[model samples]
Target: MIFRSLADIEALERTPCEQAIAARTTYGLIERAARLHGARDAFVYLPDGELDTAPQRITYAELLANVNRAANLFRSLGVGPDDSVAILAPNIPSTQYALWGAQVAGRACPINFMLQPEHVAGLLDAANAKVVVAFGEHAQLDVAGAVRRIPGIEQRQVLWVSAPGAPTPALSQRANEAVFEQALAAQPDSLQFDPRLSPERIASLFHTGGTTGAPKLVQHTHGNEAHTSWFAHMFYGFDENTVEINGFPLFHVAGAFVYGLAMLAIGATQVLPTVLGMRDAAFLRNYWKFCEREKVGALACVPTILAGLCNQPVDADIASVKVAYTGGSPLPTELADRFEKATGIPVRNILGMTECSGLVSIEPLHAPRVPGSAGLRMPYSEVKIREDGVVALRGPHVSPGYTDAARNAGMFEDGWLVSGDLGRIDAQGYLHVTGRAKDVIIRGSHNIDPQLVEDAFLAHPGVAMCAVVAEPDAHSGEVAMAFVTLKPGASIAGDALLAEVAPRVYERPAIPRRVVVIDTLPVTAIGKVYKPALRLRAIEIKLQELFASQADGREIVVTAKERGSAAVADVRIAGAEDPALAARLQAALGAIAVPVAFSFS
Candidate 1:
């Protein structure tokens, strides 16, 4: 249903004609910002190694100049309209220049600098990049290694961008690649905006998944990014005085579009907290101090960092912080309450994906903070809750499609993108994200919802945090296995939690078969629980239980594979000369309703 816009008010008034004119091109943003706030601080980066020194500052004029030079460099390299330039870098300042400049020259493809070489290589191949801009050795990125993953990708095409202290990439000289700074030296600092260039031209490509399978490259145009950045900039009431602290990796969609580019849109100062930006302990510890010292007005963080921050003692008066926005996962009501109580800034829950220019909905600055909700939809976006409670998005900010056409099929149905996230809209119009629809655990005929299971455990006195995922089984499909972190000091053993939490789920198969207590649950860079690791651990735990005592001389590994709605297990016990041992293992697995096949080494 169309959200009633009659009562919905926009903080910044924009006539239809004016909105159309402003979003003409990616260069229009930099041009506008330079004109409006040239002398204002555009980006401020705080180094993690040494906090005693003044934070690095870049004025809007300087940022624009750098962007123009970068665009010129790309042009010199023969990159033109619609061509893709792949950048493998972290959250550093040059990453921004690479982002906008490459887009101005061609299309910018930002890789998750943390992804495996093979995955990154696959993405590079999909994006069809003609050139690679890689950060130097100090960023800890294996730039050459990743490039090596792609066959026939000549090293000469790579432009190694070195940081202040970073050494030249090991392979740069041998391949005759130009240094980024030196490459721009001969290029002119000013670039003329192409009058013929349409704003709808593809500006960037961001990688999204491996959620269902291999990651797909989502296409974002100039207009798509412009609309999203402008929406957030105007919505937040950002200006020359607004100093926002951003720790999200610039390679991520949320990081580049919402946190990074949005700042440039308004000419607001962005504080890059650290290289180890997200959920970094050192940064979180000094958050309040940095806020008070730097006059940081706004900041964005994931729910996991917020949870950890809530646990820290708030000793400083952080009156300078105007707001704190959270996304990337559901913000637990309890966590939100604790954070607000400790720090006066409201933690507005938001939900977004890589496909939609990185924002679906956020709690507007003008409105009262809605607890436990992802807040209202952006004015440009049309959101519909599907019959099955799955959230769907369609708007100007929505991506045109993926780079890989094979992966594009069924991605969008009936004009609305299946967000893959399950959620609902309340009567008041606030959206509540439940969980990922694919993360459901299938046990026999019953669907074991992970969010439902995890939420129940979150209420337990001993549990600090919890994640539920399906572990492959020999029989009855997949069963729920919970990995939990207990509250500090008030603890009980992991096995005891099974008995305590079992009563919450009356259905036999729904109850988690195992509760593995952990010092901390594995989390993604964005702070959501990493379920894939837990699934692997589940298989490992089952294998260990069967063979830890039985096989002391050799290694035994068990794997779970899906077979339609049910699953089958492959058990390999090394040097299984004894047929009776296989029988014992099979019988044990069978007792748990599992069908397992054993192979001897």
Candidate 2:
């Protein structure tokens, strides 16, 4: 069932465009694939969330029919071209319907359910969604807060995906509301869906995580969507029988646009776990076992998942795996080496943002990989690093811009999508991402780039994972603080870990003021560590515990006049400090290094 490697990938003969409609816009890539591979399995998923039983498979014919049904159901609900429908769920068979239905109807906005309520509301309002398709409990909880903010959007029309044994929340019970099953019942099981679409028309809005403000929505045209899938088909070199594993969240571009849709475009069968976040021990164990049983061919996993897979002692039927592409985060050199050593499969790192619809660049097969590079640009794509260390890309598959003008303006420069990620392009053209532009830490007069600090820690054998952020110090405006997750059987204290990194780094004084030992770092759906979240958490520690537990704890007590000022200062210090302090004061303030002069008086 699993076709391993690009050699095993079957290439479908391109069907000549019908002369009558040759000039018309036809994003019929999926439809053509379905027709060519009618009897072949197109998608597979477990019937239940927690089960080891064989996956239930659906052929391309059934997939086409289901997509048609989904289109019909959306049309029945008054959905049409230009109207936006929102889907908030994990990687599942149903996600395909929501997405493809969008293409058949109008534009679909795949909103990340993991976002906070206000963030969710912002996207819903931006997309101007009419119908929302989501899981029962999670959707109700997420949308309830979002719908409250946007009074114009009705909360009653939500279609709850009824999960077994899970009750619809009391908040979701309403007369105008409709469940997914009810909607499907009204939809014809088989119907031909032929919606008029233009190649340049907006087909999907992919929301990406923002650095400064709320998430920005990336507009993908019908042509761009198909082009992206075609590019992925060529990049992955998918064949007819590729056992594609669908584990990343479908809400994101990597899951929804790249792997999920690309697999369908190539007539490949996709296997997905019943639930999201399968990187945990128990879930991964079950996943690998299933892969062995099903003989999965390829997996597009995140760096975090790959690390977990390497951490554990597993011997599954990974023999079918030919290429394992890890993206959404920089795959650690050590982890990639370990994975290749263990499974004897190349784990190529991929780098792209949601703006590019994912897979803008990737390490090609049999190519000599640089230690930390994410490989060369994919076919039909051009990648370049700007003078400011930003990754910029331009290609047919690239999205135009987001809904917000300000965001769009910042995202693109002279038509090139300027990814705010900092990276270096080597002589061989492999890209080595140094760090995120936003994650940079300014220490005193020196710019203590987090990527530089992280790379220093990465060189150490004991350090498994690390994130560097600016922590407030009274002396230095801000000092670098490193949160580290150690490797198994590796024990190194703060001083020892600091010593390992001290020699290699140029900023001797800019060395991490303190290294906090953490069990694990927070990661987004794509495996990129959520450094902002970690930085926020670290700031809280510095405020309530690190700064609060100072010897002058009482000395920090303010007069009635200074009370308000002190409270504001405390809050400011908790989050960030003036970047001028490090140079002003020779010694930096850290979680442990309390300033000797503790009084503002």
Candidate 3:
């Protein structure tokens, strides 16, 4: 959809539509433009065929009409301002309509469909949503079971959408209640609402994938989100002519706020591809072809998604793409280099969270390459390196605490959002994120952080992905264990990984003493590896079995002893001795305590 402000591009002479533009906010731009260019194309999508062949274009007039009708429907159904309406769907055209319609009347919450039932229940309850719009087959929407288990949804209404003639879910549809598609089809296509919006009106609430504790509901206001969306547009340099393709799930703030709304705020053409398995080779091939055919200008991807596309050689017409933004988790340096080299598009790193409306810092295209940075702070953001070493920020885009008090307690400090990410800003202003502070592991008086070890593994070509965990160790307090996933058709032994990381981490006792091969590491909905789960599994594994059998009850310990005026403590355990380990341990803990005694059990 092209806004009137952007339509003057093709006209040589003074165009009637070309007028100075000013809007209170991003939504204002969308809502106000319907009056002048009500019949102009607002969004174009295609379920099949090339971009030029029979694409569906919904005009601004039609969009406003349908939005008003849906808002009226919501009002008639008792959905007033402050009421919550949640949507569970992909980036289908309807998803936008549902969200915008709800925004016109009340708050809109978009839940991730990939979440399990309990997770969905938590969000539903947190949102206090009076209505939930979901697909017919959504397993998380078992209305009967949900009512029984979650008290918050007892009298809540459920709306189901199914294919045209298909039977709907038994609970909500047996009585012929409100069906999604039918509701939209029945409503007249246009409406308008008064605009006296504020930054405090909650527009959406998203829950992050908490690694250390329970996920907290992040509350964002209209002003907060509009500013974030505008900032993204400014930083990404998107214009009305930009054709942006979004395959990312519309749940996370980054995906929805940064990429999705930013596209709309710029009046750019946003493409929603068919919902297909990200790993399906045919889907990847076809999607790439679609990008080339449509001449997609901007796109965002996570590392794993990019890695999948890179596995096979593709000589498609990706040369049109100008910017490839990537984040959510650290992208492997090798993967970033390969993607940029192959596509001729620079991959800009971004750092953000659900609490901050998706983006905080973006590594500009002109910035020099830094190994593991999430880029520098964005234009409107103010970041501080707190004394405790955690990154904190305060900005218009920052959300207030979650609704739940207990969950809010640890998330904020003074007035700033205490971002859980651990990072430092260099004198040159480049930020290098090391790892989560809580994930830091200390073994035998030696501190071993997971990110350092993971970076080491990423340097190996055969190692497609890797995770490091702290396994419980009675001798050294804990031992660093590495889990490696090799590239497809590539085989690398555990010994090879140990050998590779051994030299890099030799000076520190945080080096992995054992390595194991796994097909893949468990990842969350947003593509972050589950390190807590990996640590739990690592503790259960017995590394001694991989080596030759030692005496079943064998054990040894070396104690601390004094050297000159300084006392040094030493501790070592051996099932099968390799003098190299002892030397490493002694060097790791030089001045801790004197060596006391040695015992064999």
Task: Find the candidate with the highest lDDT and give its number.
Answer: 1
Q: Rate the local accuracy (lDDT) of all candidates.
A: 0.74, 0.67, 0.64
419-519: candidate 2 lDDT, tens digit per residue:
77788888766778877776777666777777667777877878778888877666666788999988899998977788778887657866888888888
Q: Which candidate is the best by TM-score?
A: 1
Error of 1 at 184 (Å): 2.2
Q: Which 10-residue span in candidate 1 carries the lowest summed lDDT?
A: 1-10
Q: Could you give candidate 3's per-residue lDDT for residues 218-280 as a string of tens digits?
A: 787876777667656645667767787676666777557777777666566666654322433
- Alpha carbon deviation, residue 247, candidate 1 (Å): 1.2
Summarize candidate 1's per-residue lDDT along 392-454 as a digit string, tens digits. Answer: 988777888887766766666666788887888888777877777888787887877787787
Better of 2 and 3 by lDDT: 2
Off by over 4 Å in 3: 1-26, 32-65, 138-154, 162-176, 192-196, 210-214, 277-281, 366-368, 505-507, 542-601
Worst 10 residues of 3 by lDDT: 1-10
State residue 414's C-alpha deviation in candidate 2, in Å. 2.1
- Our model 3 lands, by Cα RMSD against the true structure, at 9.6
Alpha-carbon TM-score of each model against the true structure: 0.88, 0.82, 0.79
- Please give the distance, in angstroms, between residue 5's alpha carbon in candidate 1 and its true position after superposition: 8.6
